[model samples]
Target: MGPKLPPARFVLKSFMAESGLEPRLLPHLRVTNAVEGKVDFELDITKDHTNRLKILHGGTIASMVDLGGSLAVASKGLFSTGVSTDLNVTYLSGGGKIGDKIQATATCDKSRCQYKTSIDYRLTGNEVGMTLAYTSVVFKNSKGELAARGSHTKYVSKAWQAQSEAFTLPEDADIAAEE
Candidate 1:
């Protein structure tokens, strides 16, 4: 049987096509899978993403995983606004090169008031084989993988204050006010 589609899939799909988010977050962030509670994504490794070690930069992996989790929760529309309270990652392997596709899977786990999430990233190469580059990634690392293990907590917030959903910000909000 085919995978079940999430109610929010169309909204996210429209957001991607209309918002032009791919170029902003590296082409790899494009969503390849969007199920009821999960998302699958991929990124092609390139010189632009390499670090001094000539492998996939840890930061890139971190960002990908973080975005993956965010997208997962956003799919449900469970919270209006949210922030990563903590993020932990474990780098098991690394690879880099043009045309190298790295896949990542993200899921949301809201067991308590906070949203617990996790992401797993994998890189596959004909020469390097398949390697696990990241696991249990959050906004930052330190809490460690075992602690995360497909379950980490975050604080979800309201997206709107007293303004309407379609309300626009004040014209001078972007500019500094003179005394």
Candidate 2:
């Protein structure tokens, strides 16, 4: 059994509140699903998120990249998702207009267990980049048309390593705090 971490949605929503940038830009973004090293979000394309062309702004897509990566890292129990060391975004379509809904899925590309035995020195050993997370995001419109895709690399070693306490779950982790 691994450590008992807070629910993924809890970590993500709390991040939306605590992150200085997220509260200002994506105050209303909804976390639809969250799991270890992954998260999904849905948001309406508001005029505020558009450019002079009335299309979803490239800046907005980039911000989503950052947000998605951070949320994914937080889902791993690193509530304080570390600084973005790199970010790359590619615009595909218009993304959406002021009334369209878009969904974004963010996922971390690597994990300790997944690479545990691959290296002579394990990531679990807290060696170099023990908590570096390379995350990717895909954005799609309500019709399931691809809008944009992005990648983010963040250095989260501090927060990840600081989480020394582990709690075994009493049961499956899907249950909630309240209705």
Candidate 3:
């Protein structure tokens, strides 16, 4: 068997609590798998997520693509604060219908970067998996047929606040003291 996967609900809950993303932004998404440089997510298509035609909304799919890519980058355990410099999605088939399960997997490409060749080569296979690269996310329907594909280029911030520890306020901080 493959590596044991964490509970999807727990992963999502922890990610939201740490990332501070509003629950409403990704109410139906669940993290099915998360490992260094890779992440997978799933969503059950419900009436609430459908368009007037009773099919999953394109916007919803696009949002999932973005979320998948971001989470994949976060799996590296390096930086969490980043902005998508470019996102492109191509719909390969009709959107899912209500009651359908849509699955998405995001994989970060470690070799794609503008850095010097020698340094970039060295960065490969590093424990941290840090690299300035693009993330590719693929969405599939319940039957495992391709639904959409997305490419996201993210600029991970190197600022101090982007460190993982920054997500948690110090116990002695003013906010904690006030509380």
Candidate 4:
């Protein structure tokens, strides 16, 4: 990398706050890394996330693909809001059991004021290399994984350079905590 950039955690947090997703996913979503055109996020599969087969639910995987890809778009500092235009996911393996770790990695292709992002995700169990899910989301910002991945897209708005003029956070804001 030529030079490191700000983490997407703040951007995601902002989105979460504005969209009121904190109560839903803040406990699980974590920005592992964010810089330039790359963003990484992860979630641990818990008892609350299991499905009928006692496996990680498909919905959880889709969440990953949405959030993961959005981070990539946010990191570019282009759009304040990244609206998912489309999404696509694929399930390679079952996310069996609880206490599993699911990681999503996102990369971007930047243009004038927009970014095209793709997120690749994998879920791992304690011992077994559980393919809990594998997915790729072509997101601009709106959402998250395989266990959801096919074709996802979004529309993003540019951010203000001035902190004072930057986006505002809501009362029950998730991004506020990160900012």
Candidate 5:
């Protein structure tokens, strides 16, 4: 089959399109593959994303970790990936210099983010249900060497949240793709 679920990158791309920092900084990011709970991508390092040493910057890596986690959550069919609860990044290498393509894959380590249940709860019950998502990312250099790794957590328990299914559909999905 083509894919088990619709690629969530479209939603992510749309978000990036509207984001302030992402629009200027992550201009070169490309979603190679995206499915439920997983997202693979690549980026060509440029001077804007480098350090004084002319290699990938640590801040840039950190930013990618945040984005990767959001993308992973999006893979599970969530548009608003929620707020970051935690984020960690370990730089194994410099990734690469300008013009070098850095490949990365982010996988949802744990996910129970249900769109319908994200805000669902018993009004009378004092106990609240738990819904969260965790994602891990591995970055590789052009030579296939380990460049960096990271982990991220997102809290998607949208209290008083309101959402409609039609708000997140891709153009193709709402058109003839369903037939």
Candidate 6:
């Protein structure tokens, strides 16, 4: 074998530290696994994540879906920080309660290059080893039942490279030439 590859958890942890957003926006989320084009995330539903009904809030679930898909794309050893172009979620159940474990797995369905790279991702969730939701992917409650499913589309920037001035032209070149 060649040099041993780092475990997914370590790679994700390092990436999250560099990301500088997880600790703020998703303090409850944790990366359990990550590999090329795929990532798994888990969150323990707590009182803070619930709504008046004491079930997981829809907004929280949506955030998890978005993060899951984005991380899956990032796990490809590419730059993160892509902006979401579109995100859609469909709630199927209301089973996530406080103290329940929720898990999501995101998979990159397609990646394409344009002026900017675009990634399509699917997310799924499971709770207690049972399917919870499936859309682009799924979400599950602690008992392993579906909660929500979602899909996310993002435009990823290519690795930045410095451009020399000599090879560049100003945006107002046409007007300058006319003058």
User: Which model scores highest in TM-score?
Assistant: 5
Residue 150 local lDDT, model 2:
96
Name the better of 2 and 4 by lDDT: 2
lDDT of 5 by residue, 64-143 (tens): 88888888776665677778889999999769999898888888886233444433533332111135677899999988
Off by over 4 Å in 4: 1-6, 109-151, 157-179
State how far residue 51 of model 2 sits from its true place (Å).
0.7
Worst 10 residues of 4 by lDDT: 126-135
Cα TM-score of candidate 3: 0.71
RMSD of 2: 5.5
Give the lDDT of residue 11 in candidate 2: 58
Cα deviation of 176, candidate 5, in Å: 16
Q: After superposition, how far is residue 119 of candidate 5 from its true place, in Å?
A: 6.3
Ranking by lDDT: 5, 2, 3, 6, 4, 1
Per residue, candidate 2 scores C-alpha lDDT tens digits across 1-179 of 11223455555556655678776777777777766667888778899888998878889889989988887766655656778899999888878888988899988876553222222324452212465778899999767899899999988666545455321232544434322
TM-score-sorted candidate list, best first: 5, 2, 3, 6, 4, 1
For residues 82-171, what per-residue lDDT tens digits would candidate 4 score against the true structure? 456666676765544576666666665433322222222123221111111122443221122233333335544222221223232344
The sequence of per-residue lDDT tens digits that candidate 6 reaches over residues 1-179 is 11111333443444456766655556657666555566777887888788999988898878777777656654443333256667888998874888888888777666332121123223332110011111255787777878788887765433211211111222442211000
Model 5 has an lDDT value of 0.70
The lDDT per prediction is 0.43, 0.70, 0.62, 0.49, 0.70, 0.55
**Any runs in candidate 5 off by more than 4 Å, and if so which?**
1-6, 111-129, 159-161, 164-168, 172-179
Per-candidate clashes come to 1, 0, 0, 26, 0, 14
lDDT of 1 by residue, 1-179 (tens): 11323323333343445555434546434455555346665566777666876666766776666566655654433322245566666665443445565666666643222222222212322111011112233222222222112333344433322213312223443211111
Error of 2 at 6 (Å): 6.6
Candidate 3 vs candidate 5: the lDDT winner is 5
lDDT of 6: 0.55
Clashing pairs in 5: none
Better of 2 and 3 by lDDT: 2
Candidate 6 lDDT score at position 39: 72
Task: Using TM-score as the measure, name the better of candidate 2 and candidate 3.
Answer: 2
